[model samples]
Target: MDDLSKMGIDAARLPGWLRFVVVIVIVALAAGASLAAYRWYARPVTLSIAVGSLDGDAPRIVSALASRLAVNNAPVRLKLVETGGPIESAAAFSSGKTDLAVVRGDVGDLSQAQAIVVLTEAVALLVAPPGSAISDIAGL
Candidate 1:
């Protein structure tokens, strides 16, 4: 048989099974590369977050998440908007100025707000300073 190399086909040197495997591998790599390129150019879903200065952790935490997503080529991203406080943040959200907000339930018109994460634990504790006159809610 004439050497296929003479025809400038290097893959023809491999055995039939090897040739099949090589083709499969090449196809898989091409598919993966195409997917990666598509993801790299894809527009991510951008979400605006309203965070308060008082709760500084909100911006820091969300920024970290957004960085991670960007590094991973994730489909979601957050844009942080710093507000004066929780109530102001909630107002921004309610007024359609932001898509998300870090807010306290007791501080705003939260009728339209949906809970995302509870940064602070809400627990009723009964305790006082060591030299206080009372030690419970009744002391108030």
Candidate 2:
């Protein structure tokens, strides 16, 4: 054909190496395109977690939780959703929009969701101001 002649690729005269190169290039391009498509579709899924109170140390605690979760190599991505209060956080967890949430042990009934892990035990410390006679448990 006139088009073939213009390209100077005399189909019959083209060496085997040239043909091989062309095939390799086409295969490489196809592989690259497939990889790009896979990456786009297999993007990580974000799992929202309701965190009680965005103020004060709450945000820091949430950040630490997220980091720990990441280190565990969980498949889903973690997103901290601040509910501004512990009550709201508990509600969010019960409602199902949030996958996980943090709340005080006595906050509410948690029979609906099973505990995956107990991170730590929360301790209550009683502090006395100034020169108080409170030295031990019986110093009231």
Candidate 3:
């Protein structure tokens, strides 16, 4: 006990079999922790995606895709960002505020943007009341 105290080890009061069992349990715990660490490093990557609103469809679509990626344990996961409109979303993407963004081609300067996925084509429509004689919006 004096010799053990000199060496700074405190296992003197433990029985042989109890010490062996303790050592085995410690080894098992270490192995389990190592396994967990490996699993965490081996899991999928996460990415951020920005989408706009006021059309309201883009954010929902991106969110659904993110959910699907998580459900399948995909190699990549998307984090969605919601900006108010297409121009704001494009600005966010161009300014390096986000990793990915859904922006309209004509909305803002897209020199910094690249193609990832092209979803659909959309057209803007304007409606006028009947017998109003409003041929053009600028003339109204």
Candidate 4:
């Protein structure tokens, strides 16, 4: 009591019950703030992805990936936006309809697109008749 008074706390002026209530209120407020912060930090971020393919494989693949991410509790999640094909997917991306997209390199407007991965590789082959004079690419 003497030390509190010397420190100018004036503990005697506050009722014991009132002091307990004040302490409880402070603790409750701190707990609430901690809960709010945890919820904010643990929230998952979802990004919309445009996917399409002639055989409908793109959408299926992306959907599976999204499901796996959710199941694994990943920090980043994907939302699939199905389109007709690569052209439509690219258009959706270009128009800001989707945050990401699975599109072919030669399709639509890709000026603002950045390559993240190569899904597939294609080789172009030029063949001629066996008796043709064209033996090489330059001879054609």
Candidate 5:
């Protein structure tokens, strides 16, 4: 009997099952790479963010978030429209001018538009004279 390795064409050289597994692995890897490339090169999503006037923290935070998104290849185009506070935000939302807003909770009733994401707290600075004292809530 001739040895399998000594034969010119030998089934023992590489098992049929092993060949099937290698082909499957190559196909899976190709599919995964195609999916990743599609996700990376997709068009940037457009998001309209309604914020207060170009003043302080709100604008700064929005800018930072936009920048970070851009860096991550998920570009965000911010369309900042000036408004008073939450009330204005609600109105802008109702009119469909903005997709999101930085608004105050105390801006009266918000029974119109649905809240997407709520930002908890915002720091406000009160600058007064050296000898000034805030006796009551009204003073602030």
Candidate 6:
């Protein structure tokens, strides 16, 4: 204590009320820093998504997903970017304008893209009367 006072940095010399206030200030600063760190860690990550469709189904689906994520307080959120169609969406994704995109498998350049989900599938079927001459696709 004597050495600290000689160095002009003695805590023991502080008045009782002043020392209490100093301790309170230090604790408050520590608590504020902890809160700031927690907020930064808990913040959600937002990703931009490019979507396009002639019938508007792609945009609608993506919007619904974004809304659901927000409502569920998900850690990852989406921001929808509506392009004209699959080609435009693919272009946006390929050009690095968006982080994710909804595009058809056969549309545009997809060499750098990987399919995450199959949204739709198509199958062909033909029906004819039992006595009909149509037995194959060429018979029609």
What is the lDDT of every predicted structure here?
0.83, 0.79, 0.86, 0.92, 0.72, 0.92
Candidate 5, residues 1-140, lDDT tens digits: the string is 56765676566668889989999999999999999999887767777877764356777777787778877876556556657655676677667777777776555445565666776766877777787887556898
TM-score of each: 0.56, 0.53, 0.63, 0.78, 0.46, 0.86
**Candidate 6 residue runs with Cα over 4 Å from true position:** 1-3, 7-9, 127-132, 137-140
Worst 10 residues of 4 by lDDT: 113-122
Ranking by lDDT: 6, 4, 3, 1, 2, 5
Best to worst by TM-score, what's the order? 6, 4, 3, 1, 2, 5
> What TM-score does candidate 2 get on C-alpha atoms?
0.53
Better of 1 and 4 by lDDT: 4
Worst 10 residues of 5 by lDDT: 105-114
lDDT of 3 by residue, 1-140 (tens): 47787888777667899989999999999999999999999888887777887869889989999999999989899989889888888888888888888876788878877888777868988888887778987866
RMSD of each: 9.3, 7.6, 7.8, 4.6, 10.1, 2.7
The collision pairs in model 1 are: none
Tell me which residue pairs clash in candidate 2. Answer: none
Model 2 agreement with the true structure over 22-127: per-residue lDDT tens digits: 9999999999999999988877777887777645477677778778878876666779898877778888888886888777655655567777656686798999
What is the C-alpha RMSD, rounded to one decimal, of candidate 6?
2.7
- Segments of candidate 3 deviating more than 4 angstroms: 1-19, 22-26, 120-140
What is candidate 1's lDDT per residue for 1-140, written digit by digit as tens?
35767777776466899888988999999999999999778879989998886747777877788789889977888887888878889889889999998777777777887787777777986768789988667778
Error of 1 at 77 (Å): 0.6
User: Candidate 4 regions off by >4 Å?
Assistant: 1-11, 123-140
Candidate 2 RMSD to the real structure: 7.6
Which sections of candidate 5 miss by over 4 Å?
A: 1-41, 53-55, 75-77, 84-86, 121-140
Clash count in backbone of candidate 2: 0
Q: List the residue pairs that clash in candidate 3.
A: none
